[model samples]
Target: MLEEDANAGYRRLFDDDGLTFGAGFPLTGTNRSTPPIEEELRLASHAESVGFDGLWARDVPTYWPKFGDAGQTFDPWVWLSQVAAHTDEVALGTASIVLTLRHPIHVAKSAASIDRLSDGRLVLGVASGDRDPEFPAFDVDRNERGQQFRERFEAIQALWREEYPELEGEWGRLEGDLDIVPKPTAETIPMLPTGQARQSREWIAEHGDGWLFYHLPERTLEDYVADWRDDAGEKPYAMAIRVDLADDPTAEPEPMHLGYRAGVEWYRDYFRRLEEYGVDHVIVGLESEDPEEALSRFGDEIIEV
Candidate 1:
């Protein structure tokens, strides 16, 4: 089965037909100059109206001054809460949050709250984080984040299920006679782990509801999926890819980070391969010079496949 079909949260988002497209924002502005969350919500509603299935935001910290794209330029949860309220049925997601820097309780609370606010239309993609520059300011060690991420991830999961969850780890201790209120409508939020983050395949499969991966060749992705299935028992996985469409529909492919600069035809072929290789949904990131047109083109051309 495809990844969306297998994951409970994804199935809820995309329904039975499978593939869905979501627009990632700042919908219209840069990190340094975000217009307003309202503009993004408008774009999101537009996307849904035009048949895109979901929308996602990025968690960009102020301290990471040069990350260029401050991604949506707002607090992810708060922005998602607004979008959830305004839009009727679009799946709202955080393309990812940097989990290593924040407390597990906060992650649990914010994600649960968003899920509730959206009436259960939230997809939580989390990661160990890669910005070494921001770690010191938070008083967190850059080198130790991988280990910290594991401990915190476990704590959050426990908090979701076990009342008064007590966590003892090298990072810190949460000995709680307290339970996090408002567990996800599902037993837990559908958390997708990005890359390895020092987690073994066994750990990812057992812990992660799904895999959030970057680029891999078709054969390699198939192998990775098989390995993940073996380790995870029965779980789903997803990938994010960028497409830069040329004005010419037959432009040849050129490599970019985790994606390509190619024509819509190549994109169609590439997406088909991803599906054939068992990807349930390919979250498309349009980073072309023309964002609106790129989005329109993807919807008009490739989504038909």
Candidate 2:
């Protein structure tokens, strides 16, 4: 499908001029099994109301202690449905669903249903299983995640784009006699392969509707974008940034795992550089004592500027 065939969610991020931001999941900043669902929904509403472009959810089937992130402490489909019901205009997305651990038919149905429910506002970010424990929990082979991801992704695409596609894979087989119901609001849901997902860079560019990645250094990101252009041209490239904004608006960047602890001015200049590198969207995570206040500052100072 051409770029224009993408749903509203995809277009909101990629069809625009420069970069837009998405609020990351677990707004409460807890990795516990239970987070404040009502409050999180409240925060999610607050986020979109303040002009954040999208609401992102994560799919963590089972929380692994080693992973230390429960990813919103709810299912992506469920939480996003709640987000969709409460908000409008802003896109709804899965930071990623672990496809290797799910059947393609199920994923397709859930995606289509949510897409339809959200008024064509579902962007499905999919990934190979990575939490190690999840593979065994689902009786999946850890080593074969890459293959499973590729296969499931292909199956999902066919399921959406075709009426009765005949296919066979470890995930399942279709005889062309049955069909998955609730087709997407659009021709197909935009599928972004996240974190390499154990697939080659070439494969992702060739097959993915878009690409999702973790934070990279500025120089590294420049090289990555250069390579992405080689095959995918202007197809969107998105990433996650864990931010710890300093009180001083002029403080330079200080390193933190996948992002930075920097002043607002530094972030604005950084976003400009990212735009120059052809990075289309960023999933911004604010790590602060008061997430709501941080988001307020981000919307008023960082995103608005």
Candidate 3:
């Protein structure tokens, strides 16, 4: 039942009508190690009920001691699967999971498990990781991930598709006709790499079902998309924005990290601008002092768009 409705929702957004909006996966932490899972689920359900088309989970394994922001404050897969069970329609996805740290076989199994449990409402985004400390903790080399990411991606793809497939790589070797069970209902899980991780835009374009980017000024974003399309031949593009909707409906624009604190009117205008620029999806991160208020207010305004 959940899978049926979730895929139906996916078709409604991408297969049928084109443009859609989603809230970036929300975690409540004012500089903490993690937030309670219960709170995360409540926030996720709020986004779904408020008409968010998708929810993005960030992977924040260790505190990384030095890194200031601790990202999404939970294990991405565990949190996302719990949220998936709680909601029926909103597509559950990772903003970008660091594929370098974990083995590809494990990544394949976990992702396929979530995809099946969620009834095919899964969009798995992969990246080579950015933080420096995380590598040493796992006794993995930070420098070698770029090469590993490519190899791992290939292995995971083969594991998902062919039964009893053999895979060879520097990372590890899979021999003797092993078949990964529980394939994704979709032909492939959406494998979007965040930014250029030691790969050229041309290479990224040739691959990647879609492109993911941080927030940029509307005109700059337009130019960026144009450049991406020029290199990409013809693939969809997506971007995420950190949004902090002020309680004051008339809140004016103020610069925030990767986003702006603005009123609902400006927010709508901004999304319309993205639509005009031919963007396929926009993931908004509502990071206000009061997340509930921010989500409620944004839902009343932007979700209706």
154 Cα displacement, candidate 2 (Å): 0.4
lDDT of 1 by residue, 101-218 (tens): 7888889999888888777788877888777677887788878877888888888888887878788776566677777888887777777788886678788787787787877877
In model 1, the worst 10-residue window by lDDT is 1-10
* Tens-digit per-residue lDDT, 1-305, candidate 3: 01232333345345523568777765454435566667778888887777778888887677866777666777778877888899987887787888888888888888888888888877766788888888999888888888988888878888887777788997777786577887777655667677775667787776676677789887898998889878864456778888877667677889887899888878788788787786777788777666666777777788675
Of the candidates shown, which would achieve the greatest lDDT relative to the real structure? 2
Against the hidden true structure, what lDDT does model 2 obtain? 0.89
Ordering by lDDT = 2, 3, 1
Judged by lDDT against the true structure, how good is candidate 1? Answer: 0.74
CA RMSD, predictions in order = 2.9, 1.2, 3.3
Clashing residue pairs in candidate 3, if any? Answer: none
Ranking by TM-score: 2, 3, 1
Q: Which stretches of candidate 3 lie over 4 Å from their true place?
A: 1-13, 16-18, 29-31
Of the two candidates 1 and 3, the one with more favorable lDDT, higher being better, is: 3
Instruction: Compare the candidates by TM-score and give the number of the best one.
Output: 2
